[model samples]
Target chain A: MQNEMVAMLLAGGKGTRLFALTKKVAKPAVYYGGKYRIIDFPLSNAAHSGITRVGVLTQYESVALNNYIGNGSHWGIDGNNSVAGILPPRQTDEGASWYQGTADAIYQNLDFLDNQNPEYVLILSGDHIYKMNYAKMLAYHKEHKADLTVAVLNVSLEEASRFGIMNVNDDYSIYEFEEKPKNPKSTLASMGIYIFTYKTLRDALVKDAKNPDSEHDFGKNIIPDLLAKKKRLFAYTFEGYWKDVGTIASLWEANMDLLDPSDPLRLYKDDDFRILSEDARDLPQFIGKNASVKKSIVNQGAIVLGDVSSSVIFKGAIIEEGATVKDSVIMPGAHVSSGAYINHCIVADNVFIDGSRRENEDGKEVILISK
Target chain B: MPHILGLANLHGAPKLGPITERRSIASTSFLGRYAFVDFTLSNFSNSGIDQMGILVEEKLRSLVRHIGNGVVYNANTKRGFCSIMYNEQYAPAPAYNNDINNLIENHWVLDQSNADYIIFAPCHLLYRMDYRDAIKYHIQKKASVTMIYMKCSDGKNSFINMDELKLDENGRVLEIQKNKGAKKNINVSLETYIISRSKLEEFLEFAKDTSHFFSIRDVLSYMTGQLFIHSYEYQGYLRAFTSVEDYYDFSLEFLNPKVLNELFVPEWPIYTRTNDTPPVRYGEEAKVSNSFVANGSIIEGSVKGSIIGRSVIIEKGAKIENCIVMSDAHIGANAKLKNCIIDRYAQVLHCNDLKGDPKKPLIVRERDIV
Candidate 1:
């Protein structure tokens, strides 16, 4: 399976719905579950699925993302056979530009995909939080000889219209794909994950680039074009925890899922899944005296001095004495001053909450943007 | 002893007390301020010997979860920080033992940096001492290996014997006897040693041809007559907790303010991965005296002469004396705990009476109830 598939991660989305959290860094670089970034889910899933060669697409401020994922050495993506790299736009015959859409981004970086010459191309969005074995999806795609396989996750009818709804036949063949249709056909939603045959993707991208009317997106242009051509696309149903962390409330809720003392999206339990990032020094996490944490996820390099309940505290965050944090997402280097109370808040890195302030009371969620 | 590479072998050892239940040493073990492995890594980092590797055989989830990037020990740098070298294939055959040398070679490769001096220290031993001074002493004496030694007064089972110690006029070790028995023992090896990088490379080459079961002590014993194997004396508090009693005794030593200060004062800060818990909140009726309470604790009860961990809650009217409460534990109201090491997430119900002797601290593992 070496070099059989190469992954192209679409991490450049502005994620405007995430609000103030994505104000400083790219949406893919948003800190999730204390120690991990939002992009880690896709990168880890891709690596675990035997897709060693990966290229991350970034347009927004990718400094933190680049620093966090330096050369992809942490996920065993070094050496000759395996390589993970960040593919930013460069000057070419097509001219240098930011990624307008997912399909346009892939069309611009066709040279990078062509160099690897993988049999299959696995494209994924970087902002979703879930643990999936993409190898299983790849196996299904291979068995069915699909030109494109879309990872379809089941959602309730209410949430179906929010995603790219997929209408599948009895045999799991995707009959139609609709992007946020008011009148949806089915409850199976495309997770924005597509596995395309290398030739098929390249041809589709080239054709899409020439079409002036196309919006240059997989759901908006490429999938519709593929459907018009009667392409062989199947849906790989996923029955697991999957959440699109597009909004502040959703991101907060996704983090809160980890604190559920029962089953959670267990990224740490999956040995096959590997989070590819720059390796930090491996030191044991320090748990301070007088800390009263329950069902909280804390990363290394965090210094806790107060009470924390059902929260996700990122690496290097400091919760000073007499502070109370509940149902919140505190990023790295964030300081909650003494006697302050933070509830249902998403605090960014390097943010300092003033003493004794309860800003997010009355359940009014706020994303504290770093200055 | 010649220069030797030390593997903590945390997975291989039989742990008693709170350590046995924990996958790795809990981050909130030391009075909820630091992880148990902090003492070992800090000593190595402060010594300026950057080439270090940790061998993890089992319970890797906790180990990986805790040691993310090794930044606490200042090992997170452009140069070699630390690598968790795991054997990829587990082919259960006699020939697999032949690959031990390959594993050692990989360890050497991981530690291949611009460092000149090499030392191996394990996490099982707890002692706060500057190893740089010892390394400096070794270089000045022109010794091939300098093993740190402590004089044990108690007549207990010792791992290394130094009865044949021959010291010069300047108190430098001339020779150390390995197998000799005596009434009064002067030198006992602490298993920590310094060796030149080149000498370690040569030793690796020698071990490649020898039996697969070759121990580090075997190499040390081999170079006894050819090279100058000296000893560096360590006089401060040094205790090896291989047994249950040893761990229990070492834990209770924190009750005394002097011992606690000795371990923490003078700016010898033990660095570990810090958590993001809030400051300990004492309820209106909380009464704490002569105890060390870590951050994120909610103390509504009476805690005296005890060390409580992060996120622990002693409900109203509960009395804890001379106990080590790990993180996320809950002591119900009116419960009495004495001389116990409560593991993480343990819940002592209301009015429960738990007590144990100092030699044998009451052990409650994670998620347990009394």
Candidate 2:
């Protein structure tokens, strides 16, 4: 079957900065926003954009991520005409090998893409928290007749050097691509999203695989190599709430944004733009007679009997009476006993916190409880 | 080991005043997020009874929509089916519509199922049980029909308008009498019957020749002494919804953790259709106590002793006490609502004080803009 576009989600990153939360699971499978995983954002965005096929490449701690993305029906990407598949490293005529890098991951799955025969390929990172329509970017790439288009977000000048800077011309045509330059030339930073003509991407991947000295990375090798060859590269500016939840602090901040009334990332939308996830089959949240919750988000299966403020509580979490939670993110199945107080912390799944074993840190740092 | 087919019979459901005006009692919203039928359907699925049929008496639109494809209930798409059977010919005639007649109307369910026994249950009386153990007891006793009942100590106040059974020493039901709330301790019938398929065919034929108005309950009452009928005691959480007052009181009783824990088991999970919605967001001014809040709700007010459904918005300064607000309801700012039942998509705006008596709670109809 011939498809206009197919999304290839890169979900194999081992988020070490998230600490013990990603010790057993991949970065994409980390719990986020009470009821969803981080990968749900990109998968839901692809589905909402009407992309029919998706191939997710998994490497580090891929079992959970692979299981969660089975057939992609949770995002409504599985049906008679549409397909969602998990592509892992496999043994071939050459030999058994793991995915080397971002470019190498797609290079290894060229046979799978050839089977779908898609004209355009959308490369997505599964760890970011954002909502963008890839179809609009694809339309822009087609209209400009460019070989490649990278989604860019206008960051502040000070933060520009922290990201891969895209130096573009007046017409948004990219002239140079720098990976975290000391003296940044532009505020337009690459959002790690890219769309390319299938033939162009496939040829570049084959050439990159042949180079022994190449790092086989997308931002480091392929993108710069394409720019050095003077290929048509353009920047598609995306103006929305985007967050790279690469660290514990960033993940906590992203969760806190959901509780903010004026936050731009509105999850309580009434339209078709909804972030879909797996159903945990939980009952409605129950708040006890003594509970007081403010500026917080609580999901189903949670039973709250304490004072909660500025927090995000996931499914099956419990806060007993006399326990106070403030400025925290309680993952699924975590329990806080009575007389315990938690502040500015990220309680991992299944962790039990009590008064005697409480972790009371200053508001300056975010405490992580995985035990 | 008999091949049993489950039937969720909605014919005996009582009219719950305005709450059930547009929908059947089977489809009535319960506990903020589930329909009354979800409990019965979940029972079948959890009990490993794959083939089941829902006999709809009336008001089927909401029920049909809620049980779409029956996928949430783990219904088998190929072999076993979750069929919603409605009698179109006699649907307009309530007196002529009964489970016995509906079975005869949709005879394909009985004809196609390769089963030796059929379990008929009700939606109005919500409970959780594995019918496999009940079937084993029925088969071992060699009873022609098995009736499930519970021992109610508070019979005077609860289980009103339901059936009470008079049993013999051998656990045989001597008589099926209606509960008039005359006794404090009595055996209340749950209206769940397990009958052999051949015997079910005979009862259908008997009711057809008796009268068009004769329901299956009447048939069971008539043949109580003649058939080898037995009663099986079910000891668990069970609530009967016979009137609007009963619905109001029983729903509030679940606020107690002890009572709620008896119904919600960890291993035996109750399944319902899931709306992929975000978690409930409570604003800075929110104060909630003793409430069940579903997902996608935005609360900026004070809610005490209430059940808030999905996507409901409670604006700042609004006070909701002892109310049942359904999905997509909007309570405007400073609106004070007490002892009210707001239906789905209803907006209680510009009405500062809308209170009702605790005995008879007020109901705002579906999609009503007040």
Candidate 3:
């Protein structure tokens, strides 16, 4: 097996379910937790996994996404050997149109994979939060001599129908795959993470492109077609805090999970799954004499004068005297005025809650009071 | 003549004002590697002004820590480099209001050194300006009060207006237009000015004697023609983060290399207490191209043309492009975020997709949910 592998990031989805949060920005650009966007996870994972050459397939709202991913310099994906570019829809001999499906998105950007001549192509979705070593997955794929490998995780049987369900033999070879079947064959669900030999992926993409009846999706089209050809496919089990925060409720729940002091999704721990990001010039947090805080994660540059409990306060936030904030996530420099009460809310950056206010009593409404 | 004591409102504006409302002004902010209040303190210190006192509304703990002994700005000596001056009540009070007269009285008590010249400066603004030059301009013209003014396109939004500049032959201001709509051109006040210490003392005495509420702006307006109230121009960048929008705008401006050079240039260093964090580390899957990341960060994502802060985590499969993420943020795996502002210690859950407009970015405040 070669040390070099090409990773294709599927970032073209519209992410319509994210609602108003993704109205202006792409779904990936939507903020999560206290101070991060959904896209940071996959990008950081790729960097940590040591797969330098990356290709991001972008479509909706690609302009901002392109500008953000300019040559992928921040992630150390630069130089002649590394290729990081936004592959938007282009007019070709096949026909001029936007990406019809996931397979099509990758098929159109085949040139990027060809130029790299990587032994393996790691195809992954741009949304999903988990930490795994792709190098280890690649080693698994090579050791099995499998033509293709899909990362599978055990989801609840009730929710298995929502994903691409896979049945594996004792040897770990995938025996069957069903897309959103009414009755899922097994609880094992494909996480939309796949590693395929360069040739196998290229052939599958080419065949799928020629099929007029195909929807061009991996589960809907390519995987079924590959199975008919008896192509070797294996399932690799992944155990971690993996989630698809596609809807508002799911996104909210994921954030709530971090509030647990002992939550398994700890990003601050210096362990194998530590989350990595860029460094900014942030100052140390200041807790005032009047400030009474407990069981909270307060970052640098935060000034707390009021009462904070079970909350996460970002840097440069000012909680004025007489204010009470509980079970909330306050962004940097957000001002909670005197007598303002915030409970179970995620306050956006620079949001100013005027004097003497009550918000988020219901817990379902995420208050966004822009200043 | 009224003596003017200029005090910078150092505690008024937090990075994100809402987060700091109940917090004291002494508290630190996202600029931990640099103290946000240091700019104003250094300006006053370098001006060689004696007997200066800092008026802190609240959040004094972190502020005191950063300005420990005032050693860095040389305000901790026998001469009183910098002192945390608050509103002293004849009787115990509920809360302190930022009244101009109360501030004036505080200055009077601290003026045991008997420094005749008084200036009031605010700490909420970002600028490396010289007060000595403005003071010189005030003295040369024998003006009773000289307010620092910056050119503004539309004059209606400013706290004070100087449409008419009555300057001497040497361009010294003699009079200022006070009435609104007097002229379309606006010369906004930078909220710092020089005043005769005795004149300010007189105003304070009058307010105290009558037990009347007096404001600095009201005094300036009342004695406009009687005293030689004039205006001085400031040429450099001066921004006050009075609102959340302002804070976001000013922070993003640092992404521009020109703005970074102008602000952090060696000739005028913006001093702040430093944090000792390890240098930024980049992994192989990390595809960072044409971006500026500070120290103490670990990049493992696909970041392009972005500005990231210390101790940030970009998980694999996550693609962050054209965004500004502050310190200690964690990006979940396979999430896609574009053209956004992520405040400190934020986490983007796995497989979340966020995209912001090119012009209007989606700003995620500290400790917030996406």
* Deviation from native of the Cα of residue A301 in model 2, angstroms: 1.0
Worst 10 residues of 1 chain B by lDDT: B90-99
Q: What TM-score, to 2 decimals, does candidate 3 have?
A: 0.53
Please give, for residues A228-301, the per-residue lDDT of candidate 2 as tens digits: 88999999999989999999999999998888798578688635889989977888999999999999999999
Better of 2 and 3 by DockQ: 2
* lDDT of each residue in B1-370, candidate 2, tens digit only: 6687999999968888888989998888888888998899889888988888999999889998999988777656567778899999999987899888899999999998998999999998988898999999999999999999999999897787689999988889999998898999989998999999999999988988988787878988999879999989999999888888788888888888898989988978888887898899999999999999999899999999999999999999999999999999999999999999999999999789999899999989899999
Model 3, runs deviating above 4 Å: A1-3, A91-95, A271-273, A301-303, A314-318, A331-335, A348-352, A364-371, B1-370
TM-score of the second chain for every model: 0.83, 0.97, 0.77
Clashes of 1: 35
Model 3: TM-score, first chain: 0.89
True contacts recovered per prediction: 0.00, 0.94, 0.04
Runs of candidate 2 exceeding 4 Å displacement: none
User: Candidate 1 vs candidate 2: which has greater TM-score?
Assistant: 2
- The weakest ten consecutive residues by lDDT in model 3 chain B span B90-99
- Model 3 collision count: 143
lDDT of model 3 at residue B210?
A: 52
